[model samples]
Target chain A: GPKVLQIPSHQIIDMGQMVTLNCDPVSNHLYFYWYKQILGQQMEFLVNFYNGKVMEKSKLFKDQFSVERPDGSYFTLKIQPTALEDSAVYFCASRSGTNTGQLYFGEGSKLTVL
Target chain B: QQQVRQSPQSLTVWEGETAILNCSYENSAFDYFPWYQQFPGEGPALLIAIRSVSDKKEDGRFTIFFNKREKKLSLHITDSQPGDSATYFCAASGIASSSFSKLVFGQGTSLSVVP
Candidate 1:
């Protein structure tokens, strides 16, 4: 099975501070995505990136959130001046261009805001 | 509005019995449906998926029964085992264009397979 790796399995940060989560997607994957899940809730779509541009984003993707995969390196999600509600497990997923619609997700990076 | 919905937030079934998980969607544009299984502390993994053109899909002991007209589906796990105890998420996506399709997930149904 393909694997997506997320860094900083757990992190605790101040509410007003900045945080960045990194994701290393599968080698041949072309599309990358970010999803948010609070405790005992459904996984909410944040944003999806492809070919160096944001393909689609949900309302949950606030203005303070941004994503980039500079030079095909680690795909990163940055949140500036985070809010308490921003505390959740962020999962990164990637899939090939094929129409199978199978997205391989990472173990998830759990963020805690105090 | 939750586009995808699942019933019975929690369920318990004895080993070797058939566990049925129900799911429904509000969007008619959604053409692809996939079910994901998740264990604690791990990401959800794709269990099985079915396209709109198909009425049913089976993989080993897992089967998905889809009703296009009703916009609903269900996952049946036969011969359930204790290891099958996990959260199951029903997800849907619409292929509107050549670009990638994003998946919307349900709240999930937690199943406990009693041995």
Candidate 2:
């Protein structure tokens, strides 16, 4: 079974500050995704990445948010000038192929924007 | 437009009882459905999955009953145990679209199994 790992499992940042959440997807996986879940709410899609570019993003993926798979290494999601609404558990997931239809998710990064 | 919808927001069952969680989808093109279970402070994990080609898929105490025509599905946990308590999500996706593997998740159902 493949596993996805996230760095800085919990992060607290001041409003208007910048934060970068890192995801280490399975070594052999090709597709990566980010999702957000507010307290007691359903998980919502943020963005999906493949081939070093964003394939699709939801409305929740704000303009201040950006994702990159730099150097084929870590898949990072950066949020600039964070807002109170940004408080949530951020999840990173990956799949071996596009049609496998099963995603392996990381423990998640809990972001608290004050 | 929300694609996947789940019900019961929460459920409680005694040990050895059966727990059922419901889900429905709006997309007729969605052929793949998977159920994920998550414990507090942990990520979602795949519990069971069923394709539209089949009506039922079972693995251990976990089973998924899918109705392709009605675009509905359900996860049944038999002989439930205290450890079976967790939040379950039903997700759907198409086969070949760019969002092929992208999962549209249900709100989730919180299940509590009493000892």
Question: Best-fitting candidate, measured by TM-score?
Answer: 1
Query: What is the docking quality class of candidate 2?
Result: medium
Docking outcome class, model 1 = medium
Model 1: per-residue Cα lDDT at residue A67: 99
Report chain A TM-scores, every model: 0.98, 0.96
- Cα error, residue A3 of model 1, in Å, equals 0.4
lDDT (tens digit, per residue) of candidate 1 on B3-81: 9999989999999999999999998889999999999989999999999899999999999999999999999999999
Clashing pairs in 2: none
State residue A82's C-alpha deviation in candidate 1, in Å: 0.8
DockQ of each: 0.74, 0.70
**Candidates' TM-scores?**
0.98, 0.97
For the predicted complex of model 1, DockQ is 0.74
Candidate 1 regions off by >4 Å? B96-98
User: In model 2, which regions exceed 4 Å deviation?
Assistant: none
